[model samples]
Target: MKRRNLLIAVILLGAAVIFYRAFGTPDQLATGAAMVNVTVPELSETANEGEAAFNRLCASCHGRNAAGQDGVAPPLIHKIYEPGHHGDASFLLAARNGVRAHHWPFGNMPPVEGITDPEIAEIVVYVRELQRANGIY
Candidate 1:
């Protein structure tokens, strides 16, 4: 019984240390955004086209301003622009393949099939613009 108890304690201690390393301290969470690195290009006509596409397809669930719909989608402004938000690569992957909760909280963003690669690129530009406008940049 003594040996078993010691083993359990050791395991628990190891798990706690691992969790702390992975999650870091509360201070890390508060100031983490400052450590993020993103390279955002200036909005171009491509971004405008993306905005139009969003209005036609994503507006219903994501909202005209990308503020996110209650019980449907999440706001795209603050979360995406904040330095700690996500790297552009993650955003690109999520948009192209439809991510789960890494980006939005509406479950899965089904792969926007019917659209061309250029269109998807445009949409990404528009989303980035929205993020910037919302103070994410």
Candidate 2:
């Protein structure tokens, strides 16, 4: 009986999460503008390299400094991307495998091609620094 109750509780919790995700607040569903203002910070060597790579690979969609493009992609500097929520590994996975749209209405992200794991790591560093500088961390 205890196990059954625990399972029911878990199921309810999962349903609530799904409901919230599907019907998030207006801010989370915001579109057609830069979601947040981002503060730039000093970059380490690796981060600098990553910045260049990001410009080459991701900026067109994600926007300059990853502030996000309207009707394109969500900002990396937002609270949803803080390390506690979507951690570094999530970025790696997204870059490699893409992700379904849950937070925004921009639809799914396609897997980024021709980027190596090391480059993605550097990009994560660059983004993390940006997040920290902007108080998202």
In angstroms, the error of model 1 at 7 is 25
Q: Write the per-residue lDDT of candidate 1 for residues 1-137, one digit (tens) a residue.
A: 99999999999999999998667677544321222232344667888788788777666666665666654665555555454656666555755687776553346776655655666667767877767755576
Q: After superposition, how far is residue 32 of candidate 2 from its true place, in Å?
A: 6.2
In order of listing, the candidates' clash counts read: 1, 0
Off by over 4 Å in 1: 1-44, 80-84, 102-105
Highest lDDT model number:
2
Please give the TM-score that candidate 2 achieves against the real structure: 0.75
Report the CA-based lDDT of candidate 2 relative to the real structure.
Answer: 0.89
Error of 1 at 103 (Å): 6.5
lDDT of 2 by residue, 27-131 (tens): 665555765788888899999999998998988789889999776798888999999999899999999999999997778999999989999999999999998
State the TM-score for model 1.
Answer: 0.56
> Which one is best on TM-score?
2
